[model samples]
Target: MDFTQAVEIAKHIYWIGMYLENDPFQCHPYFIENGDESILIDPGSMLEFEAVVRKVNTISSMKNIKYIILHHQDPDLAAAVPEMEKLIDRSDLLVITHSRMVPLVKHYLIRSDYYEIDKHGHQLVSGDLHLQFVTTPYCHSPGAFVTYEPFTKTLFSGDIFGGIEESWEFFAGKDYFEKAKPFHAEYMPSRDIFNYALTKIEKLELEMIAPQHGSIIQKEKIAGLIEKMKALECGLYIEKEYKDRLIHTIEELKEKDLALRASMQEIKEKEELLFQKAKMADMGEMIANIAHQWRQPLALNNTLISILKEKNQQEALRSTELAEKLQEMENNIQYMSKTIDDFMHFFHPKKEKNLFLISEVVRHTLEITDPMLKKAGVSLTFEISSEEAVEGYMNEYMQVVISILHNAKDTLLHRKTKDPDISLRLYENGKDVVLDIGDNAGGVQQENIHRIFDPYFTTKHKSLGTGLGLYISKMIIEKNMDGTLSISNTQDGALFRITLPRQSKTGKTDATQPDH
Candidate 1:
């Protein structure tokens, strides 16, 4: 029911992160005791929070642990944050982690005091222990970082050197290099990310290696483990069959690259003209859209013309009533002219980066695509929780929104989901303004989820899809605007979330009511 003993893993560092007797994997969360201040590294998951707290209490008072070092925001390593915060009655308990992760980690912690370590590396002094927080993005998480204790010369490697085990042990054996190999390959993104992590560890003057999940490799074998890790292929790199295929892909890409070099100017103009190309694509998508666009106004204009024709044919085109009929026809013509203006305005790129209300952008997109969505028999609903402005290409932003709307409409009809509905929620999250677009169509198959953003990749039929919708959306958001566009499969269907940094309200787009 209690931790057996206080096993001093290093100078002032204790092995508080324990494994369950029934559980298969060993997740080691370490504790550093320096003066009245104590730092805990990777407090275990909510389920294991009690066990972790029980162990820590036996060694020292829970109130003294002033800081928590999180390598990454994994459930196994950091989900216990909320529970742990509830037990402690102190205010200085800053959760030491990454900056980009502050918002998400706080959502779980219920508190937001943090010292984010820079990706390059940052150091903080704790008594004699100089803690190094080295960021390793995409190793496992975008905000992943491992802590190093220079005082003990022990590197708490987080999940980097983690291994698989059927039993628990304090330190890793000489054969651990082989044991940990498979774990890294499966958990880490790729060798490119793995090698980036390796480079981080290789730079450290390490005497011992302590990982959260498996055994700790001692000083004598640290170099050997490093050497083994350097040589081992993990993740996609282990797929030897893909080697020739990858080479072939590279060769094909080289030919494409040579051709692309000639069109570098047009390539730079890649997405600026995306709207016109998609609208004019030989698929006649726009032709159908134009039909929808002109449907209402044209019908009214035709009715007015017919009224005039009937009166003239009957020889009753009197001067007393002719003015009203002419005025009615003029109003209908104006409506059609406005429709053409809206369509032209949407296709032109507003290349200037300026502050524009996100809600307006979203509303305008809805206006442009409303006719099409209605035609597709999909009910579209959107809620603007609050108004926030962002700096970017307003027209380009519209393209992204429209593309997503079209995607949802297509999926809803294509999947034939009952009572097809697409819901959009716009709100603020930390420093970013977020838009959540969810649908009631069947969710994407799990197999295709990961490759959803890959260029030239699509699930729709070849004729109906070029597969560039999501790829271009991702690029425009992430690369062009320094924002994030992510999607996940929901219970109802697919959920697309776009997060863009909210710009300062310095230069707002001049006041004008939304058109539609």
Candidate 2:
């Protein structure tokens, strides 16, 4: 088909209205030649329609238009129908629309033979041309239809595919995609419905889409446009490509992961060191307890020895009696050595699972922390409610208690209250054993309360804290032992509650603390 042909038909049609110039609403009214007839699609505004009619009349004197198709009942397109009806004497078919749109079309332009297409996939024939009407409702208007010319492979898509712009070029150029994006965003806000319409039209093998408003879309860009419409149907935004941006995001994520891993390793090392330090501290406390235990015996032994020395000096002691005193002194020294040996064994790092008393763990923890509590001037209290043994990893449970008590002691020290106190309460609530540690220091800061257990988040002076104490304790109790650790603010200070399943339910206990 020649580009400047007045009337040509092979498998294509030509537009014969004013060039759109740049306005999407303003389109050149043109005629698409079929065989002996011409289909005038959206015959522009009334004035543009008259200009087209005059040009057609001047060219061939074929003023007898067979059919006037209206895709939508808009006045801009259908306004010229009434004017054309007066000019043509032949029985021109008025293919208005379905019954729903008849009244709307009648309100604007009257006096015509109206044919109603009210079904999906309806066809209308004129000589050698086949026009198929596909219902495209909810595209700017109800009862909107897009006409497909099968032989020419051209789809006369109305407002559905077109957009509002003021470009007057004949076809969508390289910049068409960019230009159409904003138009669809504004006019076609219902992407869901628009996608449905696109799907319906996808069945047809269309070569050209001459929308009523915008530029005609040619073969090269039609498929690209359809793909874009499909993307819109799936609720996707077309993103700009930036390799550097993607690389930066990946690098940042990698850096964060590396930092997290490093921080976690550091926390693990600190926890191991702390446990070692606690063990040493507990040994020191056990030695003190041993000294307290042997005080009376040692004093009696000293008294007996002094008497034996005086008797020997006075030359009045029997050999057997002297041997007996020596024997008694030897027994006391052996007993003291045995007591020290037992204390050392209790503090030794042993990997074993056994049922143990919760009170013992509490006592052991308090003994280890006694010096620190005294140094901080924080009085300590313990309330163990379960006389019946509740079991768990002895060392881990003790460590958890110690960590909480340590935090409490620090809090009290920081507040510098006159009557600084730390309290440990252990009790069984139903099937679970619970431990509550609280202090008389002011509770955690309101904003920092939730983040206290988060790794590396601390309110203490930076050098004074590693910030992993509570976090590591939580990991040990909750993740390793299937227990729960929570923190809440009390009137006087922050309280930490740990709940561990009792031995009766768990059936086994771990004596050795598990690394988490």
What TM-score, computed on C-alpha atoms, does each candidate reach? 0.47, 0.42
Which runs in model 1 stand beyond 4 Å of their true positions?
1-3, 119-121, 238-244, 250-516
Q: What is the C-alpha lDDT of each candidate?
A: 0.77, 0.69
Q: Which stretches of candidate 2 lie over 4 Å from their true place?
A: 1-12, 20-24, 28-30, 34-37, 58-62, 119-121, 232-516
Give the per-residue Cα lDDT of candidate 1 at 218. 86
Name the lDDT of candidate 2.
0.69
lDDT of 2 by residue, 11-67 (tens): 446566664344456554556665446666666567576566765664443354666
What is candidate 1's lDDT per residue for 1-516, written digit by digit as tens? 223555787777788765668565778878787655888888878766766787788778777888888888778888888778877767877788888777777667457378777733587776666888887887788888788887678888888889888776667886787678879878887777778888878888887888888887888888778777777767777677776687789999999998888688677686546534554542255446667777877787788779888999999888767888778778777866766776778666777788888888888777767778778877777776658888887877777887787778878777888899988888788888899999988778899999998866888878767777777788878888989999998888899999999976534333233322
For model 1, the run of ten residues with the poorest summed lDDT: 507-516
